[model samples]
Target: MYNLKNKTMKNFMTIALLLVMVNTYAQQVDSIKTTKVETVTDTVNGEITSKKIKTITLKEQAVKTDPADKGKLNADRIFPPTKVKKTVMVDYDADPFYDEKTTLKYFELNNDNYVFRKSNDGFIMNVLNKDEEVLKANARQTKSGPYYVVNSNEFDGIGFFNKEKKFVLEFYNQKTDKLETIEFAEK
Candidate 1:
């Protein structure tokens, strides 16, 4: 029985070797055939005619929404919408406010035009302006974004953030009347 098993194993090995050899030969033949190219040209004679491609340009007149003679045209540009700018009001005239028994109220100024609120911690002088902000040693570091430095005060050219109930920022700029915020990572 061992002799019979050895004979069968040898036959199977021979068949496997034959199959591998057949597959390798098939692949090599295919590779050689793909590299071979066949080109055939047959000529048919006809009368030669000159052909020119001419481009027709259609000039489209801009459709006039408002008639040329209908409305009066102002020479001056319609400003504001066309010209964008940082229109932070220079609130230099805001009066001072102090804490009362519980609520905060403005001091006796020229008019009853000032209003104040109690700070979360202590006194927060909000009526200060751009020039007044420069007085403080802790000036916000604003290198990124559109920043314009006037004297020592830095203003974002685009705009300032708007907060609830006229409160603009961590510290409001009394000079420029814009909200001032400390928004830079310490180096």
Candidate 2:
């Protein structure tokens, strides 16, 4: 009789523990919602107007382990948010021009002006107002397409004439590790 009572007590304890664990897991939330409010004020001709904007966002809570994706590493749970890529914009002090005596062509990119002219053995790029030479490189004509291979110490650029007769220059910037493009519209 004592042995039977002990067995029953063991079964009861095991069942109670399983019920408690199942109840806790069932109460877990799958997603969360957040609300945000923004206020804007506008003034026009001495008149003022005020407005409020309300926004609601829903986000999924990260699951530590997914049953459907068993045995696979969860990259989302292990890795943090991705970092934003940093880009450097070209800056020019002056507007460049194409002079019949020296420059082969003139180009503008991102509102910055530049002149491409022939050097002794390569091409030289200069900013109209700046005293320093921006880039110097030799070009190779590729038979594959209308692209010209241009190289410099800091950048490697590929130039091609587009369908609209516009010259498009793509540069691989070494410092920022980004691709920069400039367009030269034919006049």
Candidate 3:
């Protein structure tokens, strides 16, 4: 009878230990699941969301123009080239690759406006614009004869002009503190 009791006690102890281990493992699994859920909730709260906006005020609308049409200067037809004052900067030479795309024809025309001849459905530019700023316009030979620039001096150009084909410019002699408008367009 003593032997039977000892055997029963051993079996009970083994079963008890296994039960404790199983409970501990289940508790670990629950803790891990809780941590994962909390992490997912935090991420959702931190994420930013954007919505589509569809509203415009009447004043913000733009005027519509014909799609298949070209605009021409109303000079002579309506507004005879209104004399306007503007600062013109002259650039002798600039990078053709980059300057050709960003400069405007009005600012780049040389003294002798470019002479254009029609060819291959486009005009050829025999000369180039002097104003580096104008030539930089991303303009190429359009239907209009090769772009030509008029002498700005004739348009009340900041009080400097070589009416007699004289090249005029101001030279600042820093040493003499003298700012002089040198007019020597005609030798």
Candidate number with greatest TM-score? 2
Prediction 3 global C-alpha lDDT: 0.33
lDDT, candidate 1, 1-187, per-residue tens: 9999999999999999999998766533211111111222334376433222222222212222234445656333221111111111111122332112223322212222222333343322223253332121122324674322222243322222233113222545679787655321100
Better of 2 and 3 by TM-score: 2
lDDT of 3 at 148: 25
Predictions in order: lDDT? 0.32, 0.57, 0.33
- Model 1 segments beyond 4 Å from truth? 31-187
Model 3 C-alpha lDDT per residue in residues 5-72, reported as the tens digit of each score: 99999999999999999876653321111111011112346874332222211111122334434373
Model 2 stretches with alpha carbons more than 4 Å out: 1-103, 118-124, 130-137, 175-178
> How many clashes (backbone N, Cα, C below 3 Å) per candidate?
4, 0, 14
Question: In model 1, how large is the Cα lDDT of residue 126?
Answer: 27
TM-score of every candidate relative to the true structure: 0.17, 0.33, 0.17
Q: Give the candidate number with the greatest lDDT.
A: 2
Task: Say which prediction, candidate 1 or candidate 2, comes out ahead on TM-score.
Answer: 2
